[model samples]
Target: MERTVGMSRPELIQVADTVARDKGIDREEVFDAMEQAIQKAGRSKYGYEHDIRARIDRKSGEIRLARYLEVVDEVEDELTQVTVAQARRKNPEAEVGDYLVDPLPPIDFGRIAAQTAKQVIVQKVRDAERERQYNEFRDRLGEIANGLVKRVEFGNVIVDLGRAEALLRRDEVIPREAFRVGDRVRAYIADVRQETRGPQIFLSRTHEQFMARLFAQEVPEIYDGIIEIKGVARDPGSRAKMAVFSNDHAIDPVGACVGMRGSRVQAVVAELQGEKIDIIQWSQDPATFVVNALAPAEVTKVILDEEKHRMEIVVPDDQLSLAIGRRGQNVRLAYKLTGWDIDILTEATESERRQEEVRARTRAFIEALDVDDVIAHLLVTEGFYDVEDVAFVDLAELTQIEGFDDDVAAELQNRARSFVEERNARDESRRVALGVSDDLARVSGLGGASLVALGERGVLTLDDLGDLASDELCEIVPSLSESEASEIIMAARAHWFDGEDTAGDSDAGNDDAQTGSDDAGDSRTDD
Candidate 1:
């Protein structure tokens, strides 16, 4: 026997209400979807060319199906438009551009038509559900989402979050952590994408922010704004580092994060599958902050290269392995945490390097100051790193050194000053000989030595300097930063615009003079 379904208005309303409730969508939306589906079936039965529309009464649950023919001054599509004269015959008052609805009898859906209507309703409901899921989860990004494991496919876990499903890619899950169906899992809402199929909610357990969030949850001070996490770096399932600060000094930010008897930090570590966390006290000074970030490994000395954002940490020989950790994980996390490139060295190694630098400086002094090894070594020991330092330093400073009186100090200072002056005069003359312009020498960051270096490299003119990029200038002058080079280049290019403005003013002045002469001639002619 052929299957038959209820066709009454009440029956249709009940079906819509039940579907709306089951699908968690608005009843009106469900009704609208049903009307569209009914209209599709009606057109298939009546005539494909006719403009069929359907509406369901919200309160009475009456289904009204109509075929609308548009009254137009010109009829091009005969199925949808009718001449104004023909339309007036039906209502006697119908004007052009009016729609006349012709009611059709109820549509008794055949097998093919019923299937098509069913597909349409299901598709509409599915689209509505997807939209709802996307809207709900988009605002929840960066928050912790708790859900049950729905399924596992090809190493990726699908989480059932009640209202929607989320994906936990295999790489996002912490190493060695696995989930089975029905397992209660918690992860960070890493992303939510509105794809064509549906909303894709990506969850992650290994993200660095996930650990930071866990700390915020476990430490009430962090959540209450008393403590702030400045930065976090993590090797998921192995180790992590966090730099935190506090506005209140008495609060002891690191202690607060550690909690009473290590309770607070332990809570976060437990959540992270026993990953070790080093809670560092953040400092405004990058050198201090870097030292703290590499804690538990005594830092003998820290040499900062602020321009490059790099630092060198000297530690004892035995502490090297601990400072580096297994496979360099500790230093790696510290580098990420402090945002600095770090070079770790042993104290013995640092001392050897220092000796080598001292010897090299002593040799340079001997060559430049025309002094013996003893005098050059003494100069190096007195903290004179270069001939410039010796030439510019106070004569009193040299006299204070042992075996040096006022006369000896005066003689040494004079020799240093003469050497520097001669070297400068020679270099300046060479720069002039190379055709280096005075404008090129006037660049703020370029010293005489740097200008000479540029001259040596065939960059002798203002135009040559302006055309050189920061990196290219750095090749000529190694100490030049990109910003410094940019300023010099812009200064060189300033003349280009100044010349244009100067010429424009001259032209304008000439035009005014010519016009004034013409007016004077006209006045004389009138006289």
Candidate 2:
């Protein structure tokens, strides 16, 4: 039996080497897995409670099996641990905590045990293989990968990338695109995840970075870092836009990306199934960049609200359809490329809207300040939209307006202040009628109008105000800034902490009274 086992030892090492090479795992790991499988078989043949272990000699491939017994002052588990006296009987000078190894004879292979060991080895090798794949691909994110289509199931393509496999889901593929088995495919490695089954790699053909990467491969200047891709927005399979910038002054970024007679761009378009691409020059100024992004259509005017990140684009009536593209694709791409909320308007529409705004502001001033249409129009022309602007504005500003002397400016400011006072008084009465508490009204940043708004929303007490988040308060009162609302809420919560401090003080006083009574009782007992 020993001669037969020795003869098979070299074959075991050869099998381990083959499995390690085929599965792309370390040979040492394979040996460790084999040893664990042998140890499991040995435990089954011996008693399950025994601590059996197995080792393989690296050079000679000889197998060794042993049972480990620990020396202890008391033996709780008789099979795995022995008393110090019993351990010393086997080998004198054996001390507590020493592990004694007992050699065991090799057992003949049984069919069931062999199958169990095979399963264990297979499972361990598979787990090691998955770990290897996950470690190799996790760092390769945001890169382009080329592979063959292994199979397609329900519109999702499974790509075989030689060393690993990746999935291209249906939504991630360009519209109207299809792939068949064994077809060559290229995609961007969007994500990689380690799951229970194995490592999963997700690929995308319609990702914005896919276009950027393709351009880099086509343009030498881009690959060499002379030109940089600033942004990309895609309506996949129909139209897309890319913004590129060149560090070299002499090199035209747009012309370089377009290539000689559009050869380079054409190659990328072909790979994407003829998706149309518009390459635009990038700019540091937002207005200039937006203008460039909305190419092939002239921009007559651009009104930007920097605080809101919104842009009102005015184009010629004839170019409205072109600027908006087929179903608003052009302006949509421009919005994504520039990170702006865009509203496209025709030149006629913009002009009409501006006139309407001026008329509206004039009407507002006439009603609020008790002024005539002529004065209101003049105020609107001077860019004073509301009574608050007239009330809080510099007296010099009003005097600077044409046809406005010091007396006229002074009268306007007085009326504006009176009107504001009356509005506040009215709002205060309404707030009181709504049952809003005075404590809530006294919150430092809470104005009469804000109190009325909060009361109408059923936030009628200090506790109610304290329970609200800053964003909820802003929703109820739009005029209050976020910081102001936060301050008001903090002030409302101050009373809650004050109550806690009062309770703590009361507890301390009661403890002192109890201690004084106990001292008096002790003194009386001494007397």
Candidate 3:
């Protein structure tokens, strides 16, 4: 005996409502999925060649099935198209473009057909649920999410975020942090991606922003925008540093982040598995910020090279290891936080280096200018390091030194200029001997010494120099800074574009040559 069970229309509507509510999707979408399932079963019961459609009444829950045929001048597809004459036999007002809908009889669904319909409905619902999950979490990136640990797969954690599943990769978790099923966990929503398998939500507990977000949750001032987090550098579960600033002058930013007796910062530390945090007040000055960033260690002096954005910090002999931290972690974090390369030294080392630099400058001055030790020491003490400085600087500056008169200044200037001229001639002859072209020598910001250096490194022509990157050129000539090397390379490559400019007349070429000559003169004077 064949068993046939009837489902009432209202019960169908109730099932759709229940599914939509439970799956957090729209009821209309569930109804459309149900209609598609029923239409598929109808096609199975009848011939697959018929044009069948199904709809459920929103108010009355009535099921309506129909076969639609298009009225055409002549029928091409016999099952889906009918002739106008044949269509008009059913209704006198039938036209060529109108659709003639024929009411379909109720389908007595078989067991196989019912099983197939259930599968369709289930798949459609699953698709809608995934879409909902993706859209819900995509906008929630860079936020803290609370979830339960669903399982562990090869050291990676799968988190259940109530409505969706997220992945916490093994590398993203704090080192040695373990999770078991049913454990409550919190993580930062690092990213969300839609893939063929499903929407993947990636979480991270080791990100620096995770600590920042945790602080924001625990500190009301941070959440209200009164205290701003400028930067954060982390060593995962071991240590971290945060730079914060205050918008209001009266309120201390570091104190606010630390809360009363270290409450706020302690909360964040607990969440990060006891990762020690150093909360430093941010400063607009790089030197001050770096000094504060390296805490628990006293700094004796600081030397900053503003052009290179590098700092050399000198500490007392006893404070060396403390300032450097264990294995240089303290200074490394300070470098990252301040965005500057840093070198740490003790007071004794710095003093010895300073004396050696003075001796070197004095000896260079004596050799280059043929001056006695007394005059060379006077020049070095007056802040003159190179013969070029003595040759090109204002005569008054040289005369201002003690025991120096106008005659002495003039003679020194003559000797410095003569030495520089002789050195330039020697370098030019060396460059020519190495087979370097005159075109490369004429590039702005490249002196005779730089040209000889380039030739020694096998850069012999304008095209050869133009093909080099800025750092590569810097390596070839260590005297040239990165920016200067870049400018010289760009100048060498200017000829490449001259062919493309229709308006590049002879006068334009002359102007370019004149500009290069003027820049070359400036470089010589500066040197």
Residue pairs with backbone overlap in model 2: none
Cα lDDT listed for each candidate: 0.89, 0.91, 0.90
- Each model's TM-score, in the order given? 0.80, 0.85, 0.90
In candidate 2, stretches whose alpha carbon ends up further than 4 angstroms from where it belongs are: 1-8, 89-93, 368-370, 434-436, 439-527
Query: How far in Å is the alpha carbon of 359 misplaced in model 2?
Result: 1.6
Writing each residue's lDDT as its tens digit, candidate 3 over 130-209 gives 89989999999999999999999999999999999999999999997999999999999999999888899999999989
lDDT of 2 by residue, 1-527 (tens): 01222223777889899999999999998999999998899999997899998888787787888888999999999999999899888778899999877877776669998998899999999999999999988989999999999999999999999989999999999999989999999999999999999999999999999999999999999999999999999998999999999999999999999999999999999988899999999999998899899998899999987866888999999999999888899999999999988888999999999999999998888888888999999998888877889999999999999999999999999999999999999999998899999988988877788899999999999999999999999899987767778888899999999999999999999999999999999999999
Candidate 2 structure, TM-score to reference: 0.85
Which lDDT value does model 2 have at 218?
Answer: 95
Using TM-score as the yardstick, the better of models 2 and 3 is: 3
lDDT of 3: 0.90
Model 3: pairs clashing at backbone N, Cα or C within 3 Å = none
lDDT of 1 by residue, 427-496 (tens): 8898898889998887788777888898889998888987988789878888777777788889988988
